[model samples]
Target: MPTPPRVLTIAGSDSGGGAGIQADLKTMLALGVHGMSVIAAVTAQNSLGVQGYWELPPVAVRAQLDSVLSDIGTQAVKTGMLASTVLVETVAEVLADVTVPIIVDPVGVSKHGDSLLAPDALDAVRSVLLPLATVVTPNLWEVEQLTGIKVDEENRLRDAAEAVRALGPEWVLIKGGHLPGEPVDLLFDGTSEYRFAAARHDNRHTHGTGCTLASAIASHLALGSDVVEAVGRAKEYVTGAIEHGFPLGEGIGPVDHAWLQRR
Candidate 1:
């Protein structure tokens, strides 16, 4: 039997199956990778908005990570929605021994504008989690949340990328979807920089975009693609997902994770 490309997601759980761990696992499966998850938080949410959330105890989170990494092994690891400082530190400690590529999705807020990260956890994420990242993916809001740099236009993206690169990641992918006009992302890898631009989709069902993009990048990385190549394919995948996003509950819906499979 062929060895399957394995990717792990350390993130919150979305009972609605739109974003968080649900979206990450869906993206991995759609991209032909075996997906594993160590949920950090459990959220009571749907399209309308987040109703409640509970952070998993650090011990439980560590146990799950230990079980997965010690047995199945991960080719790549992607993280999202660590609710508290303790959770962030716990994940950082658990991943210290894993040698594979790590993709950090500095998830700060939900698609519905609900705050996900605790104000106290910013320091832990910046100091501990970011250094272990092979690629740190931060959207516009998250960049400002983490670095205090405002990204108003294309030019400021470089400034923001630079601020995040200073934190210690090998690469930084600053998503510009929240900006106007064409959607573009800036990637900086210390010595070099690359910009990826895509046509903006007019769809409103763009939930789970951040999680899906990060997971897709991890999937490509597990498949042996380089940073640039993995990011390029991930952008293409997310664009398609956004264009075909699905309308679910009463509010913003989820991106169409199965769209690629049916094509």
Candidate 2:
């Protein structure tokens, strides 16, 4: 058998196996990519929410990254919750020289309204992390936190995308999942823009959508799709996952990462 395209996720671990590194790996597998992970933090999270999280030391984070990049170079890299200022800065620096595409999911809050990022790390996320992203995927809340731009209406997604693009990401994806209407996402690279819209699944058990989407993009990118194509494919996969989301643990359950295979 031919070797699958390797995709690496540098993020936190979710004990719930619903989000963070677990979601990333699952998405990558669904997309037919070899998934690897360098865990930056570990969160005590479940269907209910994140109870607590502990970030690995900067040195340990760096070692794991170096261990991966030095031996098995990846075709794409995805980033999720980095928790602290030092971790954010260190991850950015370590990934700076990477030649592959970097898909950054600016995960700010959990599905159950828990804060995962440190308050002081906002500046590091803006100054250090955003600039290094090949594609930055931020939800409405993350957009406001990172760029101070509020995306109230679907039409204003461009304004938010532009502001975020100015932060140095090659592409900016402003997610409109939280908006009133159908979930719409605006993808822009300053000169050109594309919009992807999907029927918002009414299922309230939609946890891990953000992490899954970004990882899907990385998986597609690793499989040789361009940024726009990757995002489009990812949207389709996530929409299906959301639609088929099953209830678990008496709270917001995770989207079915294996929805494709199960069908």
Q: Give the number of the best model, judged by lDDT.
A: 1
Give the alpha carbon lDDT tens digit for every residue of 31-120 in model 2: 899999999999998898888999999999999999999999999999999999999999999888998899999888898889989989
Steric clashes per prediction = 0, 0
Tens digits of lDDT, candidate 1, 214-249: 999999999999999999999999999999998897
Off by over 4 Å in 1: none
Error of 2 at 218 (Å): 0.3
For residue 156, model 1's alpha carbon misses the true position, in angstroms, by 0.5
| Candidate 1 similarity to native, TM-score | 0.99
Q: Residue 133 of candidate 2: its Cα lDDT?
A: 91
